[model samples]
Target chain A: MAYYGTNGYGDDAMDTESSGPKVTVREVESGRCDFVLQNCPLALANSLRRVMLAEIPTIAIDLVEVESNSSVLPDEFLAHRLGLIPLNSMNVASGLQYTRECGNCDDHCEQCSVTLRLHVKCSSPENLLVFAKDLIMVDGRTDDIGKPVIRDSAGNGPLLAKLRNGQELKLSCIAKKGIAKEHAKWAPSAAIGFEYDPNNKLRHVDYWYEVDAKDEWPVNQKNAEWESEETAADFTFNPDAQPSAFFFDLEATGVLEPDEIVHQGVDVLQKKLAEIINGLTRSDEGMNGGMSPDGYEPAPAEDDYAYGRGGTTPYGATAYGQNGYGGY
Target chain B: MSNSAERDTEMANGEAEEDSADEQELLLGGLEKLVILPGQTSHAASFQIEQEDHTLGNSLRYFINKNPDVEFCGYTIPHPSETKMHIRIQTWEDTPTTAFDALRKGLEDMIEACDVVTEKFTDARDGFEASKQ
Candidate 1:
């Protein structure tokens, strides 16, 4: 009867948001309903489940990124392709393209550039190669398309991406399924990034130089010091030439902390549960009692009218028998 | 017998006769058959009485509408050719027993109101007939 859709990307910076690529879909009907979600974070999916269970009839969910950066395969199709796994699996750390370079500015030149690093540590040698190969392939594709690439001079490889010890591959694809047809379809409709300044101070400058001196230097001293001015001059001061404390202020905007984001998702789910319970309770109350008119008194209970031997008659028993129950 | 005694006796007899007439009129005008059909449930209830009146339809509607919980799904009124009045009520699945009971009470009230109207109309008609005579 009612339909609702929330686009997670309404916030302009989708790329930088803690939760990436999210979509929600809800459908309701007279007797039953279905929900399809996709590309949403796990915490979000769980929260949506609670909201839906309150009133929806049937729900089917597909969590795409349970193993982060994994391919976005349709759940039904995947289930048929691969047998169901009873045990939970950990996310595999994959390579992310950090930088790339080529000589021609076009991707064809060997002299142009070479570098590739991964964000995650490979579990094994084979995994390292596999991850490296994947990153190279991705870089090649991006270079061919003329996209800007981050180049790593340290790693002489043609393509450079990073892989932290626990950093896993975060693939760009649908992370969930269920009511996700519009936004979390087979692919993400768009990619967005978020950035902010936490301190709110406008000072982002790196260097400051100041020169101070007395208005009139001793006249004789000045002339004498002219030749030795370099050694005796108090006019100029260079505060340590070392670079100002290397500082970077990158604040989170629309970027939820991992835990906070998870909690937000769960809250949506809880509200849905309450709605379902309330709907059921209301239906039961209307069935039994007929409408009672305003100011009407309830009739006496049947038990109250019953006398000693049997239930009270319309008139006295003696009068009823003698007159054969004549008219009132 | 003394005059006052005689007068009292006469008044008592007259009162008895008037009571009998009123009873006869009420019996003739009362509901002939009442049927209440609840929504979705297959079974319908039927009550037999002595006469038919338009009050049955109005009362049924009033009863269902009065209850906040009773969500009327639909209703059907019999064709003019049908002899007895039939009323159908459909209530929301969530309605409580108290609300349903209230609806039943509303129906009874409607019926009583109808009886009073019918009795007044009958009385006026009788007066006109007597005057013509």
Candidate 2:
């Protein structure tokens, strides 16, 4: 009779067996410290600060068309009162003296004058009143209802009353006109149009991997991975499971250095030594020679040692056949 | 033939009326916030405010004046202390995020654009400081 016998410790049973060398899995949360150098232009920084501290003004004005008999102000007259002028009619004050020689005899060169050219085309003429005002009402205001609008009312225009939109109009009456100082300055011409979410985390994780053993070993061959895997399986296969031997390295976070781990490693020191030797060699060669074979030279000998005799002679004693100049 | 011609004429009249109505609406909308700054003949004037303080009113004035699209009108307001003035900007919109960002950036650029002016002003101020010293 043929009997079917099953091996109690079969290959399949062994494969499913959990028995193995227990691993002390440790989870290490570490970080690497890196430096970011940001250099802000001094001029830009000062400008930003200045702007932040300065009072910014807002100006606004409006123009409305009124009926001919509406007793409304005329655009030409208003332009004249507000110091707005046509491009062709701009004239610099003659009495003003320029330290820099004025090339334009008319006292109205581009350098000293401003040109305002406005052309409005309307299909139909109605009661049109130009209303203007600077929104930023600081200290300046119109003192009177009727101010003389300074503008060129020469072309296709009828006699009309005009006034500037704002009362406190600041004109360039200083040393120079048409210069940048006469004009208002604005910062950044364009805006960054992108949206930003502050809560977003950085995509890259900053970490420093280190081997616990002092001796150099293959990283892939380390038992830590297997031990960690086994420990993780035992702990319900949770990927976030911390191993018993693994730990966090908090010193590597931001500006802090991993002094404990770094000091323990000799690679950096060795690299620094190599760099110093290279630097010294470069400096020495550069100072003495242009990398020429004859660049190096021996130090000079001492003059007294080279000239003096090795044997000692009696004080004031003369040589043989010579009179003893120092004899008692 | 007369009936067809009458129908065409009516359609034309309706189209004209519609166009006129649209134009009137546009004119009224534009006029509501209109501002006119009359300046002297042969001279150009511009008004501006800081980006932070810019409003629809100021933006309307800028639009009416036809100021340079790229270059902001130059204007500044005296600080509350009255010791110094800051540059202002006028824009067409009033969203704080956009306005502040523009203003901050514009201020930075203005410093560069007006470098010579800034330097001169600084030197003049420095001279005054030295005299006091």
Tens-digit lDDT string for candidate 1 (A77-158)? 4432211111111110011110111112322222222222222344543433222123221234232221212233543323
Consecutive 10-residue window with the lowest summed lDDT within model 1 chain A: A85-94
lDDT by residue for model 2 over A238-298, one digit each (tens)? 2221111111111221111122222211221222223223322333345311122322221
Which portions of model 1 show Cα errors greater than 4 Å?
Answer: A1-328, B1-32, B35-53, B73-76, B98-103, B109-133
Calculate each model's fnat, 2 decimals. 0.00, 0.00
**Per-prediction count of colliding residue pairs?**
79, 76
The estimated TM-scores of all candidates read 0.17, 0.17
Which DockQ values do the candidates obtain, in the order shown? 0.01, 0.01
Interface RMSD, model 2, angstroms: 44.7
iRMS of every model, one decimal? 35.2, 44.7
**Residue A183 C-alpha lDDT in model 1:** 16
